[model samples]
Target chain A: MINTILCIILAILMISIGGKRGIKSFISLCLNFILLIFTFYLIACGFNSVIVTLLGTIMFSYFILFYVNGRNIKTKISFVSVIIVLILLTFFISLITYISKISGFGEESLEEINMFSYNVNINMTNITVSLILISLIGAIVDASIAISSALYEVYENNPNLNRYELFISGMNIGKSILGTTTNTLLFAYLAEFMTLIVWFNGLNSSFSYIINSKVFASEFIKIILVNIGSITIIPITAILTANKLKNTKE
Target chain B: MSKFSIQRKDIVIFTIILILSTISLVFVNNNFKFYTSTIVKINSIEEEKIDPITEPNILGIEEDYYLQKITGTIMNGKDKGKIISLENERSTSNVVDEKYKKGDYVFVSGNDITGLKRDVYIIIVIVIFIFLLFIIGKFKGLLSIVSVVFNTIIFCIGIKLYTNGLNIILLILIESIIFTIISLILTNGVNKNTLSAIISVIASMLVLSIMILLIAGITKYKNVNFNGMSFLTVPPEAIFTAELLIGGLGAIMDVCITITSSIKELIDKDNNIETRALIKSSRNIGKDIMGTMINVLFFTYLSGCLPIFVLSLRNGVSLTNYIQANFSLELTRFLVGSIGIVLAIPISSLISIKFYKRGDAR
Candidate 1:
């Protein structure tokens, strides 16, 4: 009941304050939500989880960049950077998920699932990769777009700046945003598991045990990986945006 | 020549980080004896399928599953250097269990496989993250790392206090204040810009809290599901509210800092700039950040809930039940945090306007 009220309030707030762009953002958000649902439904219906996730993430980036923010030199460059980062991080995420064997539900959730059938015929490891990818796309898209647009503005104001200067300026802008971006990722991820941490505390779990525990390991790994994605995108976007902008001028 | 020198410095930093990461990775992988849990390295595994759906179930969705006879050598504990054999069973789904392979490390006690050894993989990722921070941010990266550590310590302290019977709402209020001060000061330093960001963050958070309170009062906290936290002994609503407070802090801080810093830049560029221009530019900056900032919040929260949502749906959970039992809390969280993000824009702009005028009045 309260959820409806909150949604209504949020929609009203966004549309009223944000105007046309706000309405576009709202639509994109709703579409993204529907896309996620459709992706999961496909995965449950026995499609390859990773492939579906890859396609879903692409659509997500497209919606966020083109549909919501619109296409331009900045969005184009950002979309390229986001894809590059996604590809690179995919390998890392898959490698870590496989090697760490942190796939599947944590032991703490074991009790909760006792009522459900376990023979769902899906590779939980692949699902882990998918979730990590989805968790990461938002911050990476945000950071890359921020860099590309900010750098575009620099290029607009002072067309004489070379690729190196633009690249450095992009890096500087990245530095200013990096701290708060990391904080955003950290706090957001950690907030999701506040209850679990409290549960650990209540159980008087030792520090070493908590760190090594499957549930804590999974959540902590996701947090670090997301932070890594957001961080690495900065330099990559800076370089890519610089080279792209510089070459176009000639 | 200067650009080349900058590139040289970057390469030097990259090399140092690369060497450090490799060393750390090697050290962590071999440090099994450091753990108190009995660790075993699987040497081989033999698997056989258990067929014939003998027992009927509600879902009636049975498939070929595996039963494994796993043999391994103990890497740690008193049974070190001894061979051990254990039996494991896994569904093809493997939702809560994993199939063990050769060269894998598993935690064991006697004959039962307890868990997997995962600390080494975690160490690898953390080292790489720190390396990137240093490579990109240089000294500020190091300071941000320090702030992260300090903030984590503060978090542990907060958890400790919560377990020791402190009021969670009050505790979180204090913690958020400390978090803002420490984070802004450490990353941004103590200056008017940082000061204004801090003021804006706290003020916006206060306004958000009041707004949430009013809404919760109107609705009487109805339909806010705490089923996801059934293990809690304390009031789940208080924890939920506290989570809402900290959840919004990051984006709020991002929006506040971006606006204030942009305003500060404009003021520094033209000290004689009029309030109208300042407001205009600040709103433009806010507009640029607002969409992405909200997207960041949306996706971050949604990721955590996706797996559970999928899992429940696959297991024949009705959509309404899933929404009531699991997603309501998530929706509330996302909505409230986003509202905080949006609210921060104008509040920070207004506060920043006043802040600059008072400090720079001549």
Candidate 2:
């Protein structure tokens, strides 16, 4: 009952203020509800969450990206490439996590979580891998795709640009976009980790543990994923977005 | 562009980074142990003193403190099973809560319970963080802190409810909404523009949320192995919920800022431009902002986990296990959020175009 009331209030408020933002937000909200429901249902239905998750990401990404506006084929292709890159991210992150088996910082928060799963005899590796894969995903994919789309659209306006010339321009612009995208995550995470890192530092334990420990391990995974993910996404998106546009532009 | 060379400023920043890295290495050399405390008899009372080496057998590697094996209950977390022995004390960690007693579930990371002395380094970090935020954000930072405080209170309550094991999904939803409100209200304000920003943020967040659950369903990602986490602040369930909520917080703020600024820019420029123009400007604005937006997401996450990366490199953890175990859900949260920002450029463009169209039509 309370949930219904809350939902109603949220609906009214969203509608009242949603003026300039469009009802797309409403669509998003409903989709989110569905996501949650689907999550529950999948858990119950005994589906392989890994594949479900991939499909989910695609579905949501599609909604979030194209629901409000249309994109050309190149843009869609670029988006797909980002997904392809994401799949690689998943593979790499899981593989690393599974292999390293640092116990993720022995007694750290992750350890505690994994420990609970241990009691249940759950495969801690997969769970941790999924969590890790998704961490840097939002920002990474957002930045790359946006930049790719922008670069293509920008280049489309310049008919003098050949493929090579266009790639150079895109790289230059992509670098600029990449700079801030990096900082947003950098500062925010820095802001949150200020204390945690310092605490680690003060311990004056061998620097190795700070890096190798589970807590640090968890963070390391996030960074590497972002680095590899971003690096791969950029080139892939640039190539894909600019693909065949050589002729399209002239 | 100014000659895209390694400019003086770049050099200076690089040097600074080098310096910070060096300092970090010093920290690494020192093992990053900050807290300093040891379980001892009441000021040399000697009666309570036990074989320090017996406790925290792991302390053999700890350069920081003497071991003291003492049994106590963990006042918090899944380890509340019974009195557990504790030994090593690091500045970042603490001993069992005061109420901890033998036969009471307790897991110790620091020295004996009562949380021996805190490491001087942690205190320093706390002091530094406070000063930095206050200095940089000024009154707004203070407000941010207040916002954090208030949000934390709510988070506490939410977690408390979750600890009791209620509706995890509902809790996550409510928690996420509250977090969004708090984040927007704190950073932007309770104004129309803020509301617009919230809508933009919420919209993207909704998208990300959908993706998360959908993937969870499709991938059965939620069937996550719930091992090893029975010792944290809350049960695995609550922790997982909190993890998602907390993980999403930074991205929420990121999107909110991007949208808010873009809209503000649109409204400022004559407020009479074609929706198309407003959108173009928004995309331009997003274009300008994306660089720093994504950089911090990558860096912040990476920097926080710097030690882990370093450790992975040092210990030679296999590429596969390292990436899988090391990468966190928060990183995924960033990916999802960044995607929103990327997509938001077009979405905001469309909305702003319509925003103007509506005004002109009316």
Candidate 3:
């Protein structure tokens, strides 16, 4: 009941305050939510999670960039950069998950899931990589879009600037954005970690034990991976936007 | 300097980090002596049996399970260099059980395999992250890293006090203020703009807490499900509030600083700019930021719930029941967080204006 009320209230606020853009933001949120549920459904129904995540991320970036922010050079460049970064990140994430064997539910969740059968024939490693990818896509997309759009605006106002200068400007802009962006990502994950930390503290688990625990390690990895993706995209978006703007002007 | 020269410098940094990380990985893998439990380096594994569980469990799903006979030598502790044989069982899903291959390291006490030695992976990532921070942020990056480490330590200490019977809401409130002061000063430095942002964040957070309390009071927190946190021994209400206070602080701080800094830039650019124009410009900036921040939080909070959501749904829980059981908490977090982000915009603009005007007077 409270959930429905809160949703209604949030919806009303978004529409009223944001006006047209607000309504689109609200719609994008709903569409993305449904898409995620569908992705999980496919994975649960025995489809390849990695493949689903790939397709899902493509559609997600499309919704986030073209649908919410609109189609433009900025969105196009951001879309391209996001896809590129995600591809590179996929290889890195897969390698790490394979080596760490950090997939599957952790010991902390065993109490809640003790009654369920674990015989489902799915690669937990793949699922872990997929989860990490899903958790990170939003932040990456958000950061790239911010950079490309901000760079594009700079290009518009200073059309005489060369590609090299534009690239430097983008980096400067990225530097400013980087601090708060990472902090936002970090704290979001930390919030999720709080309960688990409390649970561990309650049990009086030693520092080494908690640090070495599967659950804590997995959560910490997810945070770092997202930060990496966001950071990498800054340079990529800057380069792409700068190159694109210069070519179009010529 | 040529662009190629800059590229060369980057290459050096990259190669050095790569070499250092490799060395650290070796050190961490071999440093199992630091552990209290005996660490085993699995040298060989023989599959004992592949058994299909015939019984449909609570979720009405069956799976193929495996049993392995593992032989390895102890790598650390008092039993160093002793051969040990252990039996392990893992299912295809491997929800809580790990599938060990030859050449894997595991912690063991006597005959039981306890857990995987994962510090090597953590150390590698941390090393790379710190380097990346240095590469991108330079001096500022170093400070931000320190602030993050400090904030994490402070958070742990706060949790310790909470477990020792401290009031969570009060504790987190104080911690939030401290975090804002320290992180803002560390990353942004001590300036009027930082001070303006600090005041703005506190103001918005104050309003946010009051708003949440009022809502919770009016609704009597009715239908606010605590099923997701059922294992917690403390009051879920208080813990959830603390989570909101701290979780929302990040986004609020982001919004506050962005507005505050942008306004400071505008004022610094044209010292005689009208207050009305400044207000309009900041609001426009705030609008763009608000949308993106909401989207970021939406996917972040919602994505974390997907695995558990799918797991529970497959376990035969209805969609409605699933939402009631697990998602309500996440939804509440997102909603309250979005409100905080939105609230920060006007509060920050108003505060920035006041602070800037005061500066003009001085």
Q: What fraction of the true interface does each of the listed models get right, in terms of native contacts kept? A: 0.54, 0.05, 0.44
List residue ranges in candidate 2 displaced over 4 A. A1-21, A36-49, A102-122, A183-211, A247-250, B1-362
How many clashing residue pairs appear in each of the predictions shown?
Answer: 0, 142, 0
lDDT of 1: 0.82
Query: Please, what are the lDDT tens digits per residue for candidate 1 over residues B168-272?
Result: 878888888898999899989999899999999999989888877778778877767666777776777878888888888877888898889889889989999
Clashes in model 3: which pairs?
none
Model 2, B138-204: lDDT tens digits are 3344455465567656754654465466665677567667766776676666775666655665666
Ten residues in sequence with the least summed lDDT for candidate 1 chain A: A112-121
Query: Which candidate, 1 or 2, has the higher TM-score?
Result: 1
User: How high is the lDDT of residue B66 in model 2?
Assistant: 28
lDDT over C-alpha atoms for residue B123 of model 3 = 94
lDDT of 1 by residue, A188-209 (tens): 7657778888888888888768
Best by lDDT: 1
lDDT of 3 by residue, B1-362 (tens): 11312566566766776787788878887788788878899999998557664465556677777898999999887779989999898887776788899988888876999888888889978887878776776556667778889999999999989888888888888998998898888878888889999999999999988877777667766777675676676667778777877779899999999999999989989999999999889877876877779878887787777667657666776777776767788888888888888888889999999999988898
1 against 3, candidate with superior DockQ: 1
